[model samples]
Every structure is written in structure tokens, then in C-alpha cells.
Target chain A: GAGVSQSPRYKVAKRGQDVALRCDPISGHVSLFWYQQALGQGPEFLTYFQNEAQLDKSGLPSDRFFAERPEGSVSTLKIQRTQQEDSAVYLCASSLSPPHMYMNTEAFFGQGTRLTVV
Target chain B: SQQGEEDPQALSIQEGENATMNCSYKTSINNLQWYRQNSGRGLVHLILIRSNEREKHSGRLRVTLDTSKKSSSLLITASRAADTASYFCATDVEAYKYIFGTGTRLKVLA
Candidate 1:
């Protein structure tokens, strides 16, 4: 089975520019998650979607960060007015089931989009 | 705020030896998961242990959890050079968000 896939493995953007990163989850996956990883740091939660419903967006750092998964198969994380602080690797993951009672289920990940804001 | 923290930010060991990493969290969690990541790559799920499980083994990997202490440890025995990577622990907080630890960089010399 194909793993999760993301586009634009590397992106270099100027400060104040807008950037959009794409994520294609595995077929039939019901849950998707987004995270941001700074240099030499662990990934920080961004947002979550379940079958087209954005269940949680609390993890989004600010209003400049937005995400959507209208059809529930593919998702896009968009950053408006990107800042140098936004420079980091953006990761996407998917799981066959929800992380509620089946919390231990593994979540497959993509190589991630490394965005560099200058 | 971060929920989990891994100790010994970096470690170096010889192949065929054992490598151990520990993680601690500040809140209650439904489960804990361990992930491995190569440099310039995404994370790979290594194992997951529910709150009720005390220990689990996958091949040469061993994971143990202590809910009372809100801590977990991952142990790899007879490590190979290929085992060198960054190890991170994530917690399923309130069954919604997966909070990851700072991670430990392990280097195995062959």
C-alpha cells in the first residue's frame, strides 16, 4: 500500500508571502493530522480532520495558518503572510481509524514539506 | 506547551549493543507511541502501547510504560548500524492530539 504523500518536498518563500502545502493520505484512511517541526525540535500539532470534518484546529499556531480537507481524501495547509519563524518541516499523517479507543493504532506519515521562509 | 520530553537528547553506541531512551509527559494519556526518523525524512511508527499495557516487544524493540509516573522507555537490543536515527515519543492526549517529545538522536557505529 502506498504511504502518505506530500508535495513540494522543499519550498523557499520570502517573508510575508503565502504558501500552500499539499498532503495526500492513504486510500480509505479516515483520519488525517498535520504537524510542524522546527529545526532540532519535535513535531508540534497543527490540526486534525476526520472524513471532511475538521475536528480540531486548536493546535494551529495562529490565524495565519489555515487547513482544509473538503473531500476528506486530500488536505492542504496554507500559511498566509509567512514569517521567518514559520520556517520548518511540515508533516502529514493518516490512520485507518480514529485515535479514540483505538489510540494505539499506528499513523503513517509522509516525507513532509520543508518550508524555508527568508 | 509540550506534553512529552525525552532525556539524553543524543546518544552514541556501537552496533550489537543496546540503546535505551526514556520519555516523560505532564498529562494523562490514552496511549504512547514511539517513532523513528532518519535525517531529512518523516517519522516512522515503531510501536504503540496503551495505558494498560506495561510492556511490549516488536522484534528487537521493547517499550515499557508507567502510567503512575507518566513516563515511558524504549529499548532496542542488538542494535545495527541501520538503527541509527532520531527516536520520539508521542502521547495521545485526551484522545485528540498527539504531542511529541523533543526526541533523542541515536548513533550506532558499525
Candidate 2:
């Protein structure tokens, strides 16, 4: 794909079940970020990976949330023991630069995965 | 954690009218960007204004950053029904990490 791609546009998980969301960033992009957005609220930063290195994971809400980008291409966000509060839209964005290093640093985003915990 | 706080949580205006939204942040930012999100969709980058820069314009969108007040505002001129969406400000505090504001929902009636 030419742009960021995310799979499972819609996912409904039973409470306590585990769910994994996938993201494929733009090819050759140096930065990838994950965010969680609740109903009527803005996105909250979750984790960030500069290529294959996970530099920041401070925004992960809990130990149950795990994200990885092993080869620095594809990324995955996994939630263990899904709860109602975990139900939200998971967004993935890819930028061409690594932080504040570029003149034009706007990020390209995927349609996002809308997760529902029932 | 969220850094920017947008004002006028919701706004309504007629088509062809101008709409404005504001955002305030707490920390120093390397750059500030605006994004638009329609209902049930991901965010779309609108504009990016560097800290050293004061204002920027892209099409009908005009963005201003007042670093002294730690605030930014987005103005949409000649808004259309298609322009109805939620606008959010994302502040780049350090690296690729961006903290987004609560957003302002704009409704353009035709």
C-alpha cells in the first residue's frame, strides 16, 4: 500500500479475551506511533517506535498492553484480558522523520481499528 | 498524556461562514500541528507550524501559534458542509511523540 495500513477495522472481543491490532506503516518510514482514542475524546499516545527500536512506551495504560515492531516494518498492539475501558479506537501513524528532525513532519495515518469490548 | 487543551468544545455555523478554534498547551513545543477527524475515521494532518514560526495558511485553513501564551488557533474560512469535522492540535514535545488536545467539533450547516 502507498500509505499506512491497519487491519481488523472492526473488532469485538469478549471481556477478559486478548486482542491484537496490526499496523503496516508506509514503506521506508522512519517513525511509527500508536494511540488510543475513546469516544468523544482525543487520541492518547500509547507507544512509539523509531524504526525497529521502541524508544517510548510510557503512555501504555497498563501492563496488559503490549506493542512490538520486531523488524521495524510491521507493528502489533496486543491487549491482554480485555476490559470495557479498553474499548476504543486504536490509531497508527507513520512519519518520515525521527522526532523533531525534519522541516515537514506531518504523519500519515491509517483508518484505525475500532475495538469493542463486550 | 495529553498536552494541548482546545477551546470551544463544539461549534456550529452556516456554510460559507468562518469558524475558529483555539488550543492551549502547557510545555514548550518544537512544533505544533493541526488534524481533522471525521466521525468514525482516523485523523488527517491539516498543517504544521514550527515553534519559531508564528502563522501559516493552507487553502481555507489559517493556523496561528502564540508561543508566549502557549496557545494556537485554527481558522477555517468559507466553510462547507464537507468541512464539518473535529479539529485537534498535536504538540510535538520531543521526538515522534505527539500529545493531542481534546478537539473541537465543528458542524457546518448548509
Candidate 3:
């Protein structure tokens, strides 16, 4: 794909329901990131991946929020027992280089999946 | 907590006018980037200024960084209705982690 792609542009789930969001980053991109954007707020870092390695999960809000990139290509973010506060846009971004490089590389973003927990 | 803070949460301007937004951060940074978002979906990278660079230009967009002050500003010249969107400034404090500001909502009226 020419850009990062996310599946199910919108999802509405009942409170306590589990939901999964997927992201397919640009081919061979070494770095991928997941962020959550609340209404009227900027994107908040959720997790990061360097290939299949989940290098950072510190941003994940709670134990219910989990992300994985097992094969280093496609990634999934799963939220267990969703709450109303969990309603927000989930964004995915991929960069050509890793953060350690300190390179001014551009990060391509996907048209985020909007999750609405009812 | 977000490291960066953008000023003027929202601005409305007529087309052809210039739009300027400012961002301030708390700590040292490796680089600062500007991004634009439309309809509150994806964000498009606009420009980036490294810690060593003071200014950068991309077509009609001009970005300036003041590492000493820990601040950056973005200037969009001759804006259009299509330019109406949310503008955010992100600071890279460490490898791969980008701390983003709340953002400025720009509305360029035609």
C-alpha cells in the first residue's frame, strides 16, 4: 500500500465489550506507533514497535489495553471491557527509520479507526 | 501528560491571510515536527526542524525552532479553505516517542 492502512474506520461497542483494531504499516517500515486521540485533544502515544519487538508499552492506559506486532508487519490493538472513556480515535503511524537513529524521518499515518464505547 | 503546549486553541481567518501557531515544550528535544489533520482523522506531516536548525521551509510553509526557549512556530502563508484543519506540534524527546501538543484548530474561510 502507498500509505499505512487501518481497518474498520469506525466501531461502536457496548461497555464491557472487547474490541480489536488493526493496522497495516507501509512495507519494510522499521518503526510503527499507536496513539489514542480524544475529542478536542492531540494524539496520545499508546505503544511502539520496532519490527516484531514491542519496545514500549508504557503509554498503554491500563492492563485492558494491549497491542502486538507478532510478525513485524501487521499490528493489532485490543481493548478488553471497553468503557465510555475509551471512545476515541485510534491512530497508526509508521516511519522508515527507528527512533534511535535520530533522523528527521517522516511518519506516515493511517486514517485512524474511531472507537465509540457505548 | 503531554510535553508540548500549543497556543490559540482555535482561529478563524479569511482565505489568503497567513496563519501562525506556536508550540512550547518543557525539555530538550531531538527534533520538532508539525502535522495537519482534517476531519479529525489522520495527520499529515508538514515540516520538521532539527535541534540544530533554526528555520525550515517547505513551499508555503515556514517553521522556526528556538531550542534555547524550547519553542517552535509554524507559519502558513496565503491560506486556503482546504487549509482549514487542526495543526499540531510534536516534539521528539527520545527515540521514537513523540509528545504532541493539544493543537490549533484553523478555519480558513473563503
Candidate 4:
């Protein structure tokens, strides 16, 4: 794809329903990131991936949030037992640099998936 | 937790006037970047400044970094109404991870 792509631009799930959000990064980008943005706030880091490796997930709010990038090119963020607090925009970004580099490069962001848990 | 916090949560300026926003982070960082987002849109990368560098310029945008204070600022010169958007500063605290600030909402009135 020309830029990062996310599926199901908007989602509304009932409480306790499981949801999956997909991200397809630009071809061959080595680093991928997922962020959660609440209304009237900035995007918060959730998890990071280097190639297919899940390197950092310190920001995932709770055990209910999970993300995976099995092929290094595409990623998925899944939320289990959704709660009203889970309503927010989920963003995905990808960069060309790996961890070893200074990572001075910029990452392209997807339009994001807005999840509304009711 | 968010690594950075921005000041002047909301700003309104006349078109053609310069607009500036600041960001301060808590931890050491490799680089700082600014991004713009319109309503219901994805972030658009503006500028990236490496820690070793004091400042950087890209077209109408100027970014400065002060690692000592863990702060950065973005200046948009001769702003246009089209510049109306939210601006966020993201810090690379560690490898492959970026922590974003609360963001500054800039409204450039025409």
C-alpha cells in the first residue's frame, strides 16, 4: 500500500464483545506501532513491533488488549471484553528504521479505527 | 503514561500570523517529531529533530530541540487557515517506540 492502512474505520461493539482491528503497513517497513487515542486527548502508545517481533507493550492498558504482527507486514490489535472505557481511536504507524538505528526517520500513520464500546 | 505534555492546549490565531506550540518530555529521547491532525484524520508528519541537533527547518516549519530541558517547539510561519489542526509532539524514548504528547489544538482563523 502507498501508506499505512487500517480496516473498519469505525466500530461499535456491545459490552463484552471481542473486536479485532487490522493494520497493513507500507511494504517492507521494519517497525510498526499501535496507539490508543481518547477523545480530546493525544494518542497513547500501546505496543511496538520490529519486523515480526513484539518488542514493547508496556503501554497496553490491561490484559484485555492484545496485538500481533505475525508476518512483519500486517498487524492486528484485539480487544477482549470491551468496556465503555475502551471507546477510542486506535492508530497504527510504521517506519523504515529498526531499533539499532537512531530512528530519525518519520513514521506514516493510518487513518485509524475508531472503536466505540457501548 | 505519556512521555510528553504540551502547553496552551488550545490556540487561535489569525491567518498569516505565526503559530508556535511547545512540548516537554520526561525521559531521555533519541529524536522529537511534530505531527498535524485535522478533525477525524490521521496524523501528518511535520518535522523530526534529532537529539544531537539544536534545530531543524522544513519549508514553513521550524522545530527546535533542547535536550537539557527535554523540550521541543514547532513554529509555523505565516500560518494559513489550512494550518488549522491539532499538533502533537512525539518523542522516541526508546528504540522503535514513540510517546506522544497531549497535543495543541491550533485554529488559524481566516
Tens digit per residue, CA lDDT, model 3, A42-94: 99999999999999999999999999999999999999999999999999999
- Higher-scoring candidate on TM-score, 3 or 4: 3
Candidate 1, B90: how far from true, in Å? Answer: 0.5
Judge the docking of candidate 1 as incorrect, acceptable, medium or high: high
Candidate 1, TM-score vs. the true structure? Answer: 0.98
Residues B1-110 of candidate 3: C-alpha lDDT, one tens digit per residue:
76588988999999999999999999898888999999856999999888889999999999999998999999999999999999999987677889999999999999
Predict model 3's lDDT versus the native: 0.93
| CA lDDT, candidate 1, residue A12 | 99
Poorest lDDT segment (10 consecutive residues) of candidate 4 chain A: A97-106
Which pairs clash in the backbone of model 3? none
Candidates 1 and 3, the one with greater DockQ: 1
lDDT of 4 by residue, B1-110 (tens): 75589988999999999998999999998878899999999999998888899999999999999999889999999999999999999987776678889999999999
How many Å off is the CA of B31 in candidate 2? 0.3
lDDT per residue as tens, model 4, A21-41: 999999999999999999988
The ten-residue window of minimal lDDT in model 2 chain B covers B90-99
Worst 10 residues of 1 chain A by lDDT: A97-106
User: Model 3: runs farther than 4 Å from truth?
Assistant: none
The C-alpha local distance difference test score for the whole of candidate 4 amounts to 0.91
lDDT tens digits, residue span B16-77, model 1: 99999999999988889999999999999999999889999999999999999999999999
